[model samples]
Target: MTTDPQILVQAICTLACYSYLIKENFAYRIAEYTLVALYTSYQITRLFHSFIKPYWQNYAIGEKQYYFILMGALGLLLYTRYAPPQYRWLARYPIALSVGWGLGGAIARSPRPVFTQLMDVMRPLNTANNVLFFVFFMAVMSYFFFTTGKESKFIQGSGRLGRYIMMIGFGTAFGNTVQGRISLFLNRLSFLLTDWLGISI
Candidate 1:
């Protein structure tokens, strides 16, 4: 049997990765360790370049001395994971600030796209599509009602219809998830075959 060099290299790498399925051995361990080391090195380099250097240059040397102090405080707060229970409260300040800023940013932008845009799409009072949409909306809302007090027959029927709607939504979500996993697998395979093994597609 004849074998091309590139194809042979690709086959070897694929086998090395898949070997873990049979048993844990040297090849799988080497591949796993290499990936972890590479990822760690990449993250360290990125953190230095993205956060440390820029802040040191722009804030440490520039007029933004407050930012430098804030950064130092935040860094110190992160180390509080090793500190005692009473000192742990210091970490909450930065965490709360981060969450509050994030929430404020999201709230500022949410009304236009999520609320106003949806409201703008509402049709006039006399269209069939609008009537059907209102029915669907009411049905979906009925399904979420936890206080099962005196519900009308229509509301109960609407809740049943909502269950079918949710089933279709869930099926679509599952199918999309499967497709995403397959795509990620194919991406890794392409990297191993083409880049690492120098095999043409």
Candidate 2:
């Protein structure tokens, strides 16, 4: 077994986390809460070093850009949600500002990506794959023909093909997600065996 203190601690934490797979117990709860607390502290430290310290040193005080202080105050107002019920309304301004800013940014940024996707889908049908994709795309799009009558046989056929293509796409995506999770699990297992136990696999 590895005697390094850091490695030992990590091994213990890993075992504590894995214990949850068997049944929820004190060790699992401790591991869960410890991870959360550590992550929260780490994020706060990073925020201070990355944003708060730099903002204060460069913009707020150094450059005499005192308007930055208002931005800081606006961010702080988000915490007022935890205040007394009457004072909680103070959080609404920041919340609304954040939502509006995010919405506007998203609207501004969406067009380029949508246009790019449309361009990609309009690729030349020179290759077999491109031709197949074009057909699939049209069939899938036809599935959304809400105004088309059920008596339209062509539309019905295309819509049914679209549904099957969608099902296959969904299944493939789900399989990839499961494979990724399993990969993570295998990596952790390898770490336990090779790093903690000092086993040559």
Candidate 3:
């Protein structure tokens, strides 16, 4: 048993939300709204501390750089969402800047994965795992080979093997996801039964 009032309150909120599973009423609605409000408040506080405050302190007040001022002005322009129509064109500039910057970053990072996969496949086949990996990799990759096509027996067989491997991989992934959900449900039940109700198994 624990003596923390915060944990007790949290457990109560959890039970309140879970009450909907039995039947929906005021308690569940209150609990749902309370969670949304708390989350919004927490996010606002986090962003203020992590980003807004730091940016203001370093760029807005201390350094007073032209870049920061431009950036800050552009960011503020996003609030033009509520402004009249003539000034709405100002909003597009910031949207374009953010989208262009994000796309440039994604383009810069695109080659790393391809290069890594290439390097992995080119590793020496000194061990059993390496040999098997190379074989399976080639088998899977046969699905993408366009020149010879699947007219050849070898290509068809390899593609079939690759399909089976992919199916097995997908099934395993689905099973793991179900297991994870069950684990979460059990954990919540444990919190309700043991922590709140003080019932030991």
Instruction: Judging by TM-score against the true structure, name the best candidate.
Output: 2
Q: What TM-score, to 2 decimals, does candidate 2 have?
A: 0.91
Per-residue lDDT tens digits for candidate 1, residues 1-201, read 225777666566667788998999999888788779989999999999999888878888776688787667786796786799888888877788789999998889877777775685565649888877776666777888757724667667888887887788799999999999899889878867676666789
Models 1 onward score TM values of 0.69, 0.91, 0.79
**Candidate 2 ranges beyond 4 A from true positions:** 149-151
Model 3 pairs in collision: none
Error of 1 at 154 (Å): 1.6
lDDT of 1 at 196: 65
| Backbone Cα, N, C clashes tallied per candidate | 0, 0, 0
Deviation of model 3 at 41, angstroms: 2.8
The lDDT leader among the candidates is 2
Q: Is candidate 1 or candidate 3 better by TM-score?
A: 3
Error of 2 at 63 (Å): 0.8
State the C-alpha lDDT per candidate: 0.78, 0.94, 0.86
lDDT of 2 by residue, 1-201 (tens): 999999999889989999999999999999999989999999999999999999999999999999999988988989998899998998989889899999999999979988999899998989999999999999999999978938799999999999999999999999999999999999989999999999989
Sorted on TM-score, highest at the top, how do the candidates line up? Answer: 2, 3, 1
- Judged by TM-score relative to the true structure, which candidate is superior, 1 or 2? 2
lDDT for residue 161 in candidate 1, whole number 0-100: 86
